[model samples]
Target: MRRTSSKYVRHSDEGELLWLRPPTRSGHVFIKVDPTNTSSARMAMGTQQVEVGGRIPVHRHDSQDEILFVYAGQGTVIVGDERAQFKAGTTVFIPQGVWHGVENTSDEPLQVVWVVSPPGLEAMFRDIGTPPGEEAKSLTPEEFAAVAERHGMRVKSH
Candidate 1:
């Protein structure tokens, strides 16, 4: 048997929002489901809007597997050294320890929805991302890598 909860919903703008700075990627990360909002949730879910020409640098989650769904726009994705073009409706699975990254190649922003199992990557975004409306703070590549490492991710150097 599985536990159950009453129906719940989260609007597009109802979740926690964070702004990522350079050295990683300039984008808006919206964390919709995580321990903070759904204690029983076993996975973390969120959406990211990557600015034109911006990219999510190469990185790997050592402890969690991730699934990314391209919701809108187009982009190129690298998974373990293999690159592929992805558009709306494309889904990619990234196993734990596999290096992967996404680059927005289209003129419009690349919209992606990501889910990670074992729940926790949300903490990294919360720690490093600047709150919307606040002056975006910058982090050096090394500093960013350090923060990522603390959260079970290894970011490739730029």
Candidate 2:
């Protein structure tokens, strides 16, 4: 069974009620979509903004698959042992248990819509991420690994 926040209920106007969570990684900000703010279960959605020169560290979800749609800027997506260029309109799929990460290689920020199936990761982000209006902080490798583990994910060695 999954848990949801009672504060939000999905509707076209729900966007006006959703709160923007803090960055989940260094140089990145995430806007989460889940049962907390949307009528979605089984899946979680969100938008992430990766600053210029920033990168999402290589990692893997043990229990959920992920899909990423690049909405702006350019970057490199590394999945397993392969790397591919991504830009606005590009889409990438990462199977569960596969190692993957993203790097913003352009001067502009990389904006992407991210979705994870079997929704639960959003709770992890909300728990581990810095809150809005607070100073952004980077998690130490050990801390990152701990959080990932708690969320059924693993930080990979690259």
Candidate 3:
């Protein structure tokens, strides 16, 4: 029932990193893949690098399911009421509307590749994150909520 866009391909090494700082949390550098540049309208994928001791805040996507694959380093992933240890090669599946977050627990950088269905979150990252080579900028809670809401997601309260 839907028309697909032309085929597209991008190498990870050639992607640009954006500094993403969610409200009241440490930021990570992310290489986001633009949905508009791809053929599928229902998927988005990219990688992120979190420095030691950094974490992405608790959040939920209202309309999209997510998969996070740990590419390197150690960390913990909190999903709903469960917590699990993650390391290189760990893969996590987060259903839509589930509360989830990630924390880098090791002394080295944590790298993860993430995919979201019904692609849109990458656009939110572009809207909220700072461009490469620029310092990361912090957002107020209200501002963060607004941005996330625009992309069909919400920042969960701690």
Specify the poorest-scoring 10-residue window by lDDT in model 1.
1-10
lDDT minimum window of 10 residues, candidate 2: 13-22
Q: On residues 1-158, what C-alpha lDDT tens digit does candidate 2 reach at each position?
A: 12334445433223211123223354433545676566667788776777777778788999899999999999899999999987899999999999999999999988887899988677766656655456545666677678779999888754
For candidate 1, list the clashing residue pairs, or say none: none
Q: Which residue pairs of candidate 3 clash?
A: none
Query: What are the per-model C-alpha RMSD values against the true structure?
Result: 4.5, 4.9, 4.7
List TM-scores for all candidates, in order.
Answer: 0.92, 0.80, 0.86
lDDT of 3 by residue, 48-148 (tens): 88778888878999999999999999989999999999899999999999999999999998888999987887888777878767777788988988888
Q: Which candidate's TM-score is highest?
A: 1
The residue ranges of model 2 lying beyond 4 angstroms of the native Cα positions read 1-24, 135-137
lDDT of each: 0.87, 0.72, 0.79
lDDT for model 3, please: 0.79
Candidate 3 ranges beyond 4 A from true positions: 1-8, 22-32
Candidate 2 local lDDT, residue 112 = 83
